[model samples]
Target chain A: MNRIAQGLTLVLLGAAALTSTVPTDLYLNWVKPGFGPFLIAAGVVMVLLGVLVIVAELRGGDQALDQEDVVPSGAAAAGDDGPARSELDHAAAEYAGHTGDGHGHDHERAPGVAWLLLLPVLAVFVVAPPALGSYTVESTGGSSGPPPRDENGSSRFTDNLSEAAPGEVVELDVQQFVMRAWVDEERELADREVELTGFAVPTEDGEGWYLARLQMACCAADAVVNKVLITDHPAPEADTWWKVRGTWVEPEGELYDASEHEIDTSSVEAVTDPPDPYE
Target chain B: MSERTTPERGSAPDPATSLGDTIAGGWDDRGDELPPADWGRSSSSRRTGTVWLFALFITAMAVAHAWLTDDLTGQAFLAWATIFTAISFQALPFLVFGVALSAALVAFVPTSAYQRFIPSRPGRAVPVAGVSGALLPGCECASVPIAGSLIKRGVAPAAALTFLLAAPSINPIVMIATAVAFAGQPEMILARFAASLLASVVIGWVWVRFGRADWLRLPSRTHAPNASKWEVFRESMVHDMMHAGGYLVVGALAAATLNVMVPREWLMAVAEAPVISVLVLALLAILLSICSEADAFVAVSLTDFSPTAKLAFMVIGPIVDLKLIAMQAGVFGWRFVARFVPICLVVGLLSTFLIGGILL
Candidate 1:
């Protein structure tokens, strides 16, 4: 029973890992894209291990059983004939020693606690939870903007912000928009019309919604929210994706002092979710 | 099954045999034969039961999911599930790599090799092991089983335990990730290395002074010398994966729940105070249970907290977190974890503050 449970658990986990990464891009919602090959390799290894276990059990069962009946009694009677005994007899003796002490090490079996592995197998294969959306952003209290500047008072994004020709709308992701809005000392985004895409999050006051996106370092578990308040535009339904053209509205504070960044929207259009939901 | 039971029944009536002798002799004779026959017989019966239970579980989940889909759309419960699945999925490959390496050590490496390499004295060996942690480049999940296997191979408990605490934090991959996360602040990377090394060594020394052998249930060595190395490797790898993966699931559940349920405002409220912020971030590290490689990015996001408090978060996270605590209790006994976790936590905090004060 324990052997079957162990083998089944391995196979199930392997299958779950494979299905998550192989056929679809479901794993992207959970981890970074670079993890694809590693997860697939791990899955193959697990499945091979599980199959090897079952095969070994089937092939060796009867022969080992026949050997067991003769070896133990023979070894016990001729206890002093240690050097004369075969290697199989020596292994049987070690197995006896393990079982003699109450700490019997079942070489082929797993602990009962291992049955809990079914939980993740069920979760991944059955529930199939979606990616983090507007709920996470609101719950985590929205974006804290970008990291502070270095001691030299320079920002990485400063040089990347090129001067745009007048009336040309620049395209930026929600992350870059929030970063420049907070740390860019030149106020480069203030006069330039820019385009950003994110899922909508309705504001509490019912005036205008926040355009929000989650940025993760490794996986969804460490994801943080980056959002911009879209003022003067009507609120869209929560979590619906949209592309908005807007000009940055300079807030009343020094850089990194303001809790929120606002953008005055010129136009709003409903759009499908992006291929990569996170930045 | 019937044929196997006949011998057992015949052997049971020996009046000359004492119960202990009968048990030991019977187990010795039947160990190879009975387990296989029993496994074959029980598996067929149990497989059906398992299949039925699984179908019922799926059906129930389908019903619940259908009912809850509308209400749970963009809700906290869905958020919790996403985080839980993400953590488990992200950690799974690293855990597999760790168990595979651990199994190789048990099967391929000779026990004598450990004694010949490590110093005899616990004091000298502890720092040696701590410094050697930089060799392993994987995250925290990989180190726990490797540490457990190191102890199994006769390395000193203090030295192996020190390796566990230090490997995840000071490794090259984690350091690079930290450097990228705190891009311009080279001091943060140096401080992390110094603080993690100091804390790991200090905790190892403390263990050498105060720890008891009986508190830790040393991992049992498996497979006799006569067994093939491939057989030993396969057996140990499967066993360790089953054992550790279950605990990983437990850790993921706790972290996910805390991630969704704990309000960000509470952490923000304490971010301004110097001493309280450090303590708060330390506690937050335990609760968040973020992987050490990714934790720097999360630390950078906490713009409200001081560099010292962020240092505490980074230091305490890799060494002592909900996931590590669960894995430790699974590998070592609960008694060992109860003592070991607190010691690591306190040492990690003190080392962080000391290093952060000096550098930042």
Candidate 2:
């Protein structure tokens, strides 16, 4: 791969990382807000280095290319093809910094596998894709039951759900509502009006949508769907972010059954997805 | 070949005094013209028609940007991309941390420092390297490139390999995290430590005895060029970042694809058979590739599975995964990963099972 190409790709990748992480949108899709600053710093460093590589090469510092360290010996193996070996040997010989054949850095070979590195850069900057949506919800069987324990493996409802006077409006997350419903023996939410916010995920039965939030443990890869059903109401548009004023209606089914701990919405409003969409 | 250096291939040159001249006439037979002095000032520094290649990539990216910005984002693409970027974002800092360390060593420290501490014999170095894993606190991303850099500086490959596996799995931070996550069951912490140590050492010994020289494409000892120390540090850092970052993405993509493709329901389908449970948990370890420090929490929460199965998940998550596979392939090359990952999986499974069964 050409050293200049390597440098430019670095610059682009770094730039994309900087822009994507600094904004609030990244929180919507993958991870928490913890890694934003680090990514920005890494992006700055990468761009600086990319610029340096180009400058060094431009100043007739072809020796800087030797820093590329095209050690062809690594390409050798017990049973490799002759052409692959020769191509590697040729590439190695071409960039033999100090103790091999005497040709300076050559760009003629093209960026071989190094070109693969550019794919992420393209995906990041070009595609600039968004977060998990209905397709993921459908594929992964959506938020199922309450976790085996309060995510910590304890038997009791771990969240602090204190007594709210009758008709008092209390705000809670979709997860907290479910946890209390699953394990709280005190029936603290029996008569309290609780408001919760999440995006609308369509029910498999097509009767209504579940107000759901995805809980990411580390990053998007391990996100767990935590959803509460919305009943006695028409389903809003799929994946529509919602803030609903409602109270918990006792489910006709067992605990954590889609119907069991659902919210009976007195009022519902459709809103845009939040900056940090996942819970 | 010099007495200290291992003989590689036949290409040799007359007494080369400077790195510059060696690169200039190095491949005298490979007739590629040097771009003019003013070529440096050009917008596209690429020469000999490579500009078109760069231009094509940029053009394709531009078109993608246009199509993506029109509010036509698909959930599938968005989900895939989000997962992809998240993996990259997560790995970015650790990879940079590793590159910074290796770069410092390459730029600042004399090779003699490594030689003095690390044993020369492959057999003797394995345990020392494996035990030293307890000291490095970072995850797998940090260890892979460092191991590659060490091999470049003449540390035995066996030792480097041993440290690569052990550092991420058995480090103090990971052990402490495991202890905290499994508060009631102290056995998990000890089991993870023992199993990881056993696996790493076993792999090291196996490599010492059976690993083919060609299996690993050992890194070249790239010395800092004649520049300021800052320049040397920057150069080493940049170079390692480029190589390692590229492979890390490949690993990330494989993991993201698997994350979506394999229905998450499989996690709930735990068979009662001990062997099946072990295999399922082991497979989950490969797919999830959770950070070593936090995997204990994930494992302990899975009360439906046997403790032994959860133990297998704890031990195997850090050792083998699609991400680790891609990274190992990235640093050590696919040749090494081809044999190495399979060997690791088998040995890691047995180690976890044997140790976890006895302890848990």
TM-score (chain A only) for the predictions, listed in order = 0.80, 0.75
Q: Evaluate candidate 2 and give its CAPRI docking class based on DockQ.
A: acceptable
Alpha-carbon interface RMSD of model 1? 12.2
Which CAPRI category fits model 1?
Answer: acceptable
Error of 1 at B240 (Å): 1.1
Off by over 4 Å in 1: A61-106, A149-155, A158-160, A163-168, B1-74
lDDT of 1 by residue, A19-90 (tens): 677766777878888888888888777766765664455455444434333444324333333454444233
**lDDT, residue A248, model 2:** 77
Q: What is residue A242's positional error in candidate 2, in angstroms?
A: 1.3
lDDT (tens digit, per residue) of candidate 1 on B1-360: 434443443334222222233233323323323343345444334533553444454456456546654555547777888899889888999999999999898779987788898997989999999999987898889899898788777778889999999999899999999998888899999999999999999999999999877677643543555779899888878878877787888899999999999998998888999999999999999998999999999998888899999999999999999988988876775778899999998899999989999999
Cα-lDDT of candidate 1: 0.76
Worst 10 residues of 2 chain A by lDDT: A100-109
Q: Runs in model 2 with CA error above 4 Å?
A: A63-111, A142-146, A149-158, A163-168, A185-189, A249-260, B1-56, B115-124, B172-186, B212-214, B221-232, B288-304
Candidate 2 structure quality by residue, lDDT tens digits, A44-117: 66656665654454445454344334434233232222242222133222222222121122221221445666
Q: What is the C-alpha lDDT of each candidate?
A: 0.76, 0.67
Model 1 per-residue lDDT at A41: 82
Best by DockQ: 1
